[model samples]
Target chain A: MIDIHNLDIDMGRARVVSNLTARFETGRLHAIIGPNGAGKTSLLKAVCGLLPSATGAIRLDGHDLTALSLRERARLMAYLPQERAIAWDLKAIEVVALGCADLSGEDSLKHAQQQLEVMGLSDKAETSVFSLSGGQRARVLLARLLATEAKIYCLDEPLTALDPAWQRRVLEVFKSRAAQGRTIIVSLHDIGLAAQFADDLWVLDHGRLVANGEPEAALSDEVLRQVFNITGTFAEGRNLRIDPQALPEHGA
Target chain B: MRVKSLSLAGGLLISGLVLMGALLIVGDVPLSGADYIEAITHPQSLNGEIVWGIRLPRNLCAWGVGAMLGVAGAVMQGLLRNPLAEPGILGVSSGAGLGASVAIVLGVGLVPFAVEASALLVSLMMSAVLMAFVARFPDRQALILLGVGISSLCGALMALVFNLSPSPVTTTEILGWLMGSVENRSWQDAALCVAGLAVAVGLVPRLRAGLRLLTLGEETAQSMGVNIRHVTLIGVITASVLAGLSVAVAGIIGFVGLAAPHFVRALGLRDPYGVIWPSGLAGGVMVLMADGLIRVMPASGDIRLGVLTSLIGAPLFALIAYKSAKSWA
Candidate 1:
């Protein structure tokens, strides 16, 4: 379980996230959904220990993460940024192997290869990441995250450029990881996708946590209108479809 | 793949040794293969003194400078995640040149060891300044742009020093040093290059893992347990030392740092760790070959080592630019 209390993140020029308090239960997929500049990414960054919060205690299993060394904290949590930053044309397997920064043994290679197989990227293991398609690149980076095998994962918009097929595939992978008792917190933009796959949703509006509960209750029309200002009907189907009629234009 | 790269590094090492041997035999005082063998076997011969005093030191200077630049280039590229992140491009080399010019103008170079000491000091200072500037923006385009600005500033300062020279002789001496020559370099110069090489070799194993993580970018590497600031500082200082030491020894030899790692990568070494040693070996060979080629050529005036390197390096740099233009865009 991950718990964040009074987490406020300042981004040099302005505060991106403020007074955010939440507890993310273990063994579930929790999605952070918000409008643009809602501080979804900032909250995740603070919790993952990437961004230092002005006032907050991020505890993992009741242990304060700030008290732990970076190495120890890395063992407990992993973060995947939104950017697809494969700067070099390293082989796919090599890219995955980078996740084991603390481990230096023959076992690291085996673990990386196994994670690649889990992501269904085993065949392209010898290929360079620069040549992979956008969706495939996303999966390769996901494989890097899985190779960490950390207890908690903070993924920011992991499905940004992925297609529908890959979206379902990655969601299934996340579900399987959650089933194995790993806590996964992902910041997502697609409300319908979050509704279908996320076990819980934390809705944010301008850096404030407006709703936090099961996806079905938290993603209702009233919350959507208030948080996103979009009046919509939440229709459940093969894909959770949000049929928007109009925007309630009080203010964004 | 590791085996293949190791073998390539071995091949490069052997080629460098062969070039060094050939260079020893074919200088102004030409000696036969058998005569050269006799000079090696008979240490008391006059040829032995010539070989040890002149030929060996000069060759070692070239080899060591090449290795330093190559390794430093690889580290800078890996740290900054920019293919064009050589010391020359980032203003470190020009900063060293400025230091050397200061030493010359002040007649401090007449004092043994002061030239390289001052050059290394100024080079590191300039590198720290650029790194501090880079930290403010910490983006790809911003880094290259800042580097260009710093390099131009240093180049202009060097020109100003030249213009302010009190005598034509001083101007000529400064110009000759700027041309980058290893000719008539003594053992003391070679020792400085060797020292830089030893430091780089010592740091490579530790830097390998950090550089590998760094290639993924600062935020991601920090998440993976890498202290990005520590790695960046070490990497930049080491690269500056390497470039400064080389400049102190061989003048401003360009493009070896930029080209050596690219050559290694093109030869199928993708891992940053895998690229380090091979790139060093390739760099040594490049400078050795360039120096040897100049010695062998029957030119009217002595061809400058820096000129030949830039002659080859400039075109190769253009090719790299053309190929990687899309990525920059």
Candidate 2:
């Protein structure tokens, strides 16, 4: 479980995440959804200790996050950033092996190959990442994240640039990981997907956490209308779909 | 992969030694086979003195300086994630040149190793400024721009020193040093180069893992628990020391650092961690071959080592740029 209390993140003088308090339970897939400039990425970055200006308490299980060393933090949680530019012609297997840094050389490669197999990239293991398509590169990065085997996974916009089938496949992978008792927090832009796959949802507006609960209740009509400036019809089960509509004149 | 890289390095080192041996017999006074054998056996003979005191130290100095620059260049490129990044591009060589110029123009020889000490001190200061800028910005383009700015400033200061030189002799000496040469180098200069190479070799273990992780970019490396700042600091300092010592001993040898790693990459060692040793060896071989070309050339005046390296390296650099442009296009 991860706990964040009164967390505030500042970039320069502007507050990107202000007074945000939330608790993410183990064995759950939590999705954060917000409009543009809604602080979804900032909140995720702060939780992963990437933002040095973040203030307030962040605890994992019972230990304070700030008290852990970087390696220790990394061993407990893995992060996949939105930017996907790799610097060299590194082989896909080598890129995945980087996440298994604590393992022995042969074992790291073995585990990396296994993860690649899981992502259906076993054939591309020896291929350079520079030559992979945008979607394939995203899958390679996701394989790198999975190879970490961390207790908590923080992925920012993992579905971007992925096809619809691959997006659903990735969400299913996260769901299975959550079933195995890992805490998975993913920030997503697709409202229908978030409502369908997420166990719980956290909605942000500007810099505040406006709603937090099950996806059906957290993404309430008023919350959608005010925060997302869109209308959505919510229902039970897996039949929830957000219909596209014209925006109001004055906005939310 | 590791075996391939090691074998490549060993091959290059042996090739360099063979070239050095062949060039040992081609100086101004031609040596017969018997004379070469006698020169090797008798240290006090005239031929012995020419071989040991003159040619050997000069060849060793070239090899050592080239190796240092090559390793430094590999580290700089890996750290900056730029194929074109090298010590010269980072203003380290120019900074060292400015230091050497100051010592020469002001005649600050009261202290031993004054020129080397000044060169190292100034280059380290340049690295510090660079590290500070990176901390604030953490952008590759900004870092390159700052390096160019620093290089321009150092170039202006060097020119000012040249204009204010005490005498024509001083001006000539500074100009000769800036042009880069291994002529008349002594055993002490060779030993200094060896020491600098040793320091760079010692830094490999510390830099290897971080550099490999950095292939995924800085943010990802940091997330993987690699301390990017610590790695960057060590890389910059190591490159500065190596480049500074090379400049202090052999003036401003250009392009060895830039070309050696590219050559290694072309040889199929794409891992940045595995590229360092082979790059150094490739650099030594390159310098030895260039020096041999200088010896065999039928020109009236000696061809400057820096001039030859630039002539070779600039074209390779342009080809790399053109390829990158085409890929982007």
Candidate 3:
């Protein structure tokens, strides 16, 4: 379980994430949804120990986050940022091997290879990372994260450049991992995709969490209009869907 | 990763030895293969002194300088995380060149022991100064700019030395040293190169964690338990020492360090430590071959070692750049 309380972050006088408090337990998929200037990515970065917060307490199973060493935090939560720039022509297998450095022996390699197979990247084992396409590189790096086998997975803008098929595939992978008792937190932009898949949604507007709950409750029309200022209607589906209508004729 | 690829380093070692043997073989004093064999076996003879003192020392100097430059270049590129980066990119080599040039023109006896030491000192001082300048900068791009500025300053100073040399002999000597040459190198010179290379290679693996983590970025590496400042300081200093030592012995040979590691990386070697030895061996062979080309060239004036290496290194750099450019697009 991860719990953050009243977190205030300052990066050179800019509050990327301000006074945000949230709780995330294992065995669930939590998506952070927000407008353009929202601090969704910053919030996740703070949780993963990549960014330090100025005020508040972050606890992992009741222990303070500050007390944890980087290697320890890395073991507890694996993070994959939005953009990846691997500057070398490292083989796919070697790239995956890096994720297992904290582990030991055949167990690590075997587990990593298994994760690669699970991600459908086993065939490209010896290929260089530079040889992979955008989607493929994402999956390959995602496979690297899987190899870590951490209790929590924190990701930022993972679906940005992915095609719809990849978007679905990646979401399904996240669902399976969450189902297996791993906590997954992702910052996503596609509201409809968020509506269709996320177990819980936290909406942010300008560095503050505006609403937090199930997709139905959190992405309601009133909250969307008040926080995002979008004149959109929420539709009932398996999950909440936004049926955004055209601007009223009189407005022109 | 392949065992065969690793053995290429071993092959390079053998080739360096053979080149050394051949360097002894085809000098101005033409000795038959059997006669050359007899010189080592019969040490009391005058041929023994010439073979042991003149040719063998030169061969060792070539091997040492090559290895030092190769390893130094590898470490620098890895530390900076930029392939175009070298010890001289921070003005270490150019500073060494300046020191050596000043010594030559002013009739300062840089001679056997003092020249290499003085050159090493000047280069080390310049690297330290660059580090101080870099520390004030918050980003990698800014630090790189400082390095370029320092390099430009050193280059201008180097050009000034050439312009002011009173005699043609003094000018030619400075040009040869600055352009990179291993002529008339004594055992003392080879020892300096060997010592610097040994220290650099020995110290690189300790910085392996920092080096591997550095690829992630400075803040990331620091966040991962690496003391970024210390690791960078040690890495650059060791690199500067090796590069300075190379220049002290063979002038300013370029490319072996840049090319060998790139070739090894291209062949799929991943571990930084694994690349160090092979790159060193490859560097030695590359330099020996370039030097050998000069000896065998039917030209009137001596073709400089630095010129030949740039001839080799510059093309390989272009190919790498072109390949990376296409792939990135």
Candidate 4:
């Protein structure tokens, strides 16, 4: 379990995440949803130790995260940033294999290949990552993240550029990884996907954790209307789906 | 795959050696195949003096300096993640040049060894300053612009020293060194290059993983257990030291460092690890060939090594820039 206590993230003079307190349990997918500029990325960055917090503590499995070395933290949790432009023409497999930078073993390549296959990129393993489409590249990067085999994952918009089919496949991959008792905290833009795949959803607005609970309870029509100011219907059935109707007129 | 890359490295090394041999045998003083053998066997002969004292040292110096520039260029490009990054274009050469000019003007390099040592020190300091400046502006275009500005500033400083010097002869002497040449350089220069090269090559294995991870960008590399700031500092220092060695030995031979790695990549090997050795070999070949051409070329005045390298390297640089621009478009 990962516990964040009163986390406040500041970017220069501006406060991005303020007094954010949350706990992420293992073997469950926790989704962070917020509108644009809602400090979703900043919060995720702080959780991954990419951003420093002046007035909070992050504990990973009872150990203080800030006290750990960068290498130690990196080995414990893998992070994937939102911007995904790879600067080199490395092969897809090579990109994935680099996730094993801290690992020194003979089976690293095999593990990387397995992860590539998990992302349905086995065929393009030898192809240069630049040659792949944006969606394919996204999958390849996902494979890189998967190759880490870390205890926790902090992903920011990992679903970008993925098609609907690949989106489901990626969520399935995350679900399976979570099933192995790994903690996952992901910031997502798609409410429907979050509602469908995530075990719990945390609504963030202006850097505060507005609501946190099971998706069915947290993503109610009233909360959705209050936070996003949109009319939406939520139903828990055989085929889970959330359809947002319209943005109400101002002050209506 | 590893084997194939190693073979390519081997081929490059063999080709570099052949070019060096060709340069050694065919110079202003023509020697037959038998005379070449005789020079090697008997060091006391007249032919031996020409071969050992002049050709061997000059060619070795060329090889060492060329390799240094090439390796340094590859490291810079990988570290900066900018194809246009090279020691020459990024003001590292000019920085070393300015440092050398300072040493000469101040009479600090009254001894030849002191010249190289001063140049290396100043070059490292300049690189650290440049890196610090670059960190302020993270954008690519801003970095390039800063390099240009810094390079011009170094050039202006060098010119200022020349203008202020009391002796016209010193100005004339420094001017020739500024143009850069491997001519009349002795084994001591070659030895100095080897020392610098040892420093450079020693830092390579430490940087290899970081270089690969760095190609993915700073954030990702850091996530993958790379200390981005630390690696970049060491990388810049190493590249600066290599460029300093080249400058100390041959003045300011431009573009070999910039063009060599690009040349190697264009030929097929794209891995940063694969690029390092072959790039060094390509650099050595380029300098050897340039030096050889100048030796044979019939010119009214002295042919400067810097001019020849720039003549070839500038066009290559232009080509790379044009291609990169087109790709971006």
DockQ of each: 0.74, 0.71, 0.31, 0.62
Per-residue lDDT over B44-104 for candidate 2, one digit per residue giving the tens place of the 0 to 100 score:
8998888998899989988888899899999889988878888887787899899988987
Better of 1 and 2 by DockQ: 1
Candidates' C-alpha lDDT: 0.83, 0.86, 0.76, 0.82
The C-alpha stretches of model 1 lying farther than 4 A from their native spots are A102-106, A233-241, A250-252, B33-38, B41-45, B108-114, B124-150, B327-329
Pairs with steric clashes in candidate 2: none
**Local accuracy of candidate 1 as per-residue lDDT tens digits, B205-286:** 7777678877677778888887766676667667877887889888899899999999999988877767878888899999
Evaluated at residue A208, the lDDT of candidate 4 is 87
Indicate the docking level reached by candidate 4. medium
What lDDT is reached at residue B80 by model 4? 77
Instruction: Output the number of the lDDT-best candidate.
Output: 2
Query: Pairs clashing in candidate 4?
Result: none
Q: Would you list the clashing residue pairs of candidate 1?
A: none
Q: What's the distance in Å from true for residue B100, model 2? A: 2.2
Let me know the DockQ for model 1: 0.74
Model 3, runs deviating above 4 Å = A52-57, A103-108, A231-238, A246-252, B2-5, B33-38, B42-45, B130-139, B163-169, B207-231, B266-273
Docking class of 2: medium
Q: Provide the lowest-lDDT 10-residue window in model 3 chain B.
A: B216-225
| Least well predicted 10-residue stretch by lDDT in candidate 1 chain B | B134-143
What is the descending lDDT order? Answer: 2, 1, 4, 3
